[model samples]
Target: ELGLPLEVAVLGVLESGYDARAMSHKGAGGVWQIMPGTAGHYKLRITDKLDERKDLVKSTRAALLFLRELSKQFNGDWDLVLAAYNGGPNYLRKMLDQHKKKTFWEVSQVPGFKSETLEFVPRFHALLHIMKNPGEYLFKIPEMEQAEVFDVVRFSENISFDLLSKYAGIPLEMMEELNPHLKENEALAQVNFYLPKKFGNLVLKKIRKYYAKLRLEKYRKKTLRVVRYRVRKNDTLLGISKKFNVPRGRIKRYNRLRSAHYLRIGQILKIPIYRSVKSRGRVAKKYRRALSRKGAYRVKTGDTLSRIALRHGTTVARLKKVNRLKSSFVKAGVLLTIPSTAKFQPYRVARGDTLTGLARMFGVSVRAIMRANKLRSRHELAAGKTLLIPDQGS
Candidate 1:
């Protein structure tokens, strides 16, 4: 453990009111208000599926290590360390050199010093004082309940958090709250899942039962076929899933893919092909009707023509042609026409489009919709915004 000052723990209260999910407009996140660059420098994982900055245990360790390094740079002067942490260390060092000051108070008087950084140090000290002597400030800190002990269960294969919650007899929301690093409902293989110590053995026993059920199902289902397929150039998991009429999760599970984004060309994969008893005539009719329909898609933040096309199972050329778009650029809130399909449809957020209603209509979970659009909360759903309704199989 780093030999940090006891008062350093109070920094979380000042940074984010001890909220692990807190995010600042400046891109700092989590209780420690760590920026993306700082998290990367400390080797904290930040990926599309996982952000360790929101993990209390990992982020706390990274923050302390960072603070310890800053302490060394400032020669154990916590005041300067705090200043450098708020304002870039390089900026603080430059200010110190220019002003020939050894302390934060002196350098803070310099003209170029930011007001935010200037107040940051004093704000921390004030909070530390108030925390140490709460009675003097007429603040009655409530006693906290005993902390719940957690047990980590590592999985060799990808599993749904929904399934875990059901098996462990824990609420889905509680499971997500306990495991903030998982961006989606499905926990990736090899990742350690933290569960209450009481439910650890129960979860393991249920997982074994689940596997037994899977084996039995496989044996009983005569229509199930295992086909060997080689990964091709420009092949994506989504593309492969679409081609085989399989869910992305199933494809990942069968192949034991750790990261869905990484698929090597020439790699062999075992694809489970479930033969349908229904004739091809019915499917053909459905496909023709789907192609005849036109749908509207509302552009959201970080939308690109290519990405939008991919999500909707179309091409950039087709999207541009349909929308009559002169350029590849698509701005947020812009409505574009798309060819309607059963798998992926676009729906505008109506005045009364509650998160629950939309999820119910799409036959998906609220969390699934939120995860798809990178929405932190249900409140992010606003009227007139376009939302991508994912396929139920997805």
Candidate 2:
């Protein structure tokens, strides 16, 4: 019955305060503080170009889907849902069983969890109270007779948000407020634009008119139908499939992968969710930013998969292929792409390596290096490789 997106946002505000970059300092980052491993479960790209976790809109969608499952596990109690959302469902399940309290109220009294989770219920109730009749809490949103969220559509190329604001006659500041699914200033750079149900069609028309270069596209939003699996000492695809009511073939397909030997500790997989809502998008030429695929990556010295994927929003697998890598084995200065962006630090000039040689080694132009690094002097190479080698960061 609680199908309203607004109601979901209300809980997210309590979970992450609606900040996409909210990280837990427990190595958690993004509005949801989604750990890298857990995020990988949803196939949320850890690539360099874009951090989907920092993407408020994408992350919120993921969070909502996650909450739906938690609700079922906790038997529809918002209190238990909150606890599970914060502490994870399995942790709560174990505690609930140990406490002998049939309901969330019973589990709240159980010992040994973070204090934030312990205090979650009362806070949620108070917040919900304030939301239903905001006068009590002084929270006011301009009334919109009903709460129907916008439909997200993809664009072909990056467009400035300012242009959209000018067209909509709405303040640029209010764009994200209206569409909580976008990154800050993402409307213009966004290949995907979300518009209110009634208003989306109108906005699409206007966008096509002014931006003739925009092409129509089909878009899909990422969902949160991720599986909850803890890395075992030695679990394989078949092992996990047997544990979670999923088929091995289905898991391989979503991951765009073929190998079962590569999984490591803390690796969580997003089992194909048979019963979750799908995110659909129509593409326009103007929304040209391409979505990345997942892949494997080996660690190189002075290398981090996160940094590699950050530049491209790409995962690690594809990074290796772009670099023509044969295996995960890597040494210092081994260049590899994680899974995300296509940008990376180029090979820096070494003590004896000439700039021209370095460029030739990486199949790039010396002039490009000069321009890329803003180098004015031809003799400015530092003894320890001064050139920044590039990689198609995941």
Candidate 3:
């Protein structure tokens, strides 16, 4: 650790109350309230997926190093250093030159200095004093509990915090609390994951077991394939579903479409196709049995005979003939018999499947699979993880 005044630690209290995720209106982030430019200067990563300014250890070290540099610049003047840290060093130096002041106390009386910067140093000192002498301040602090120890585990591949928590038997909330800097559900590769000290070995063992299972399942299991299709002029969801021999609901789900009427021409949709593998026959049998049991569907609002027929893989004529309907219209809460068709299937991802590759192989778009799974990126696809495949033709 860089040797500096013990009082410097209290700056975090004044800055953000030690909240790693604390952000200012000025776009400063983390416990130290580092600005974006400062974070960039310190080489902290800031991306849509990652913002290292919220990383406790990294941000603290950067802040301390920054304080050290400021100390040297102000010639060991802690007051000036604190002032410069609040306002920019260049601004503080400019104020000093204009007012011909040698110390922060002298500069404080000048009108040109920012009020926030002028008050920052004093507020820090006040908090430091109050913390030092709580009895004098009438503050009855509760007895502190022994801090929970943590062990860091480094990963070379991307994995979800959900999986890690499950594997380690740690609560997901606790994991998120411990690692607040992880912005997404999936932790990126080459990052440190902190686990409770007692669960470190257990997490490692479970993760290894998961990887081993993935390797074994790669050659032994059949997975769902994805296909992508672009909407054509005047294309409708029902028409597109019929063309692909997939259900309309599945199309909406895969593409994250909120309504059937919102389709735009040239919009690409992901279509999940069930590939014919040698192992698929057994799965098909089980799937058929399950589908047979689902024989009735209750009519809902906006239900049309054609739409229901398209969803159930039947024709309007077949539905009308079977149900003995006099009209094409149906009311909500009416039960109709449905002939069984293919439903969504769950497929565990294997070692070699890339999102793009899966899209290509199944004739679906990468965006479709991502939308269906609610995945932030393709990187979330890990081996031994199950994905729901939208059913194609029976």
Candidate 4:
């Protein structure tokens, strides 16, 4: 409907091999291999949690609109538009102005034409040619398979796929096969989940059950804070409890960890820290200033105050003094207010210091490093930049 040639869709094939979620090293993503900047220009939503560039139909429509606009800009020269799409229009225009090339064919011989752009038109032409005359090329194309019919189910909260598979009566393998758009073990909130048409009723029924559990009155309270902890190697329930200054029994009850044996590497545990008036009342007025300067810590699977103090450039004595703690005993989900000192320490990022390595070295979680630095997963840690290390559990 965009008044473009049918053969123009071949660019999609060349760009992404028709993979909707295809992403290039240069951050070009989706079926049309649109860069973030181009996707923004076309009004595609791109965020850490959501990327609409991978929506096949929307991306195709956007691609068509962009191609049409480019065609008009190049004065109906589809070849030049295609070339300009491969190389930038501005770069091509500058080359044209410098070399006095009136057409794409003339520009192709010019030195300014990129090597990749030089082959782009020919590749598109070859794809169109092959598609038009498959027999002439001695190629026998396979019939396209029909797409599976599925019903869309939206979840407002993040729920693990294991729970979803069990409750919805869908096999875990089938869920994985159907939801290729989802990352491995992801439980993204407020997203549409595609299920087989037959299981629509089951999915809806389970959705209610799933959400009913989340409607607890305690969860609605603003005073409670939740932290996520991933169990690292050789992590124990006792060690984790001591690190956060909470009871081990409460930790087991909160996370539903029946036994210490159930603890496994990379197992994510939810740590709930209560921040109430009672907890705050324990600290003295003089210590309140220390608490004010302190960073909040949500205990993780294997954290210790020694490690925490080392990471934050503080001492255990100072931590106890600041928090007015009677003992070093901590729980996994308990929030510990670590007092900050006059000597605020910031660690400079060094070469080969990845987030994971730093987390392990500092006895904190990777998420803690991210949270402390206000960073997202895609953010790169440049060497020599100071990163504020949180003095407690993540």
lDDT of each: 0.78, 0.59, 0.76, 0.70
- Better by TM-score, candidate 4 or 3: 3
Q: Estimate, for each residue in 1-394, the C-alpha lDDT of model 4 and write its tens digit.
A: 6778878878988888888768888788888888788888998777665565776655678788888888988999888999888887888888888999889889899764689889998898888889878899999878776674776676777767798877767788877655545665444675656677777678878778766666544543542544445566788887666555446776786776779666765455655555553356543232233233336666776888788778877788876655556787666755576554543236778777788876764556778778777898725799998887664432
Which one wins on lDDT? 1
Question: Higher-lDDT candidate among 1 and 4?
Answer: 1
- Residue by residue across 1-394, what tens digits does model 2's lDDT show? 4362356556666757866656676766666667677777776665534566765666656666777777777667777787787777888888877766777777776666667777876787777777789776666857767665666666656555687777755467656655433454655344456665666677667778776433211111232334334345688888766554456876765664668666654344555433332222222111111111233344556765546656556655755554545674557643232333434454535456666765654445777767777889778878755455453221
Candidate 3 lDDT tens digits, 1-394: 5779989989999999999889999999999999999999998888887788887878888899999999999999999999999998999999999889999999999976799998999998899999988999888758777675887777768888888777757788877876777889667787766777777778878888888677545622433544345566798999877654557986786666899998754355765545552247565444333323446677999889999998877888767754657888889976575643544445678788788876654445677777778989779989999876543222
- Give candidate 1 misplaced runs (Cα > 4 Å): 143-148, 219-394
TM-score of 4: 0.49
Query: How do the candidates rank by lDDT, highest first?
Result: 1, 3, 4, 2
Model 2 ranges off by over 4 Å: 1-9, 27-38, 54-57, 98-101, 136-142, 147-151, 157-191, 194-394
The C-alpha stretches of model 3 lying farther than 4 A from their native spots are 141-148, 221-394
The local lDDT score (0 to 100) that residue 92 gets in candidate 3 is 94
Better of 1 and 2 by TM-score: 1
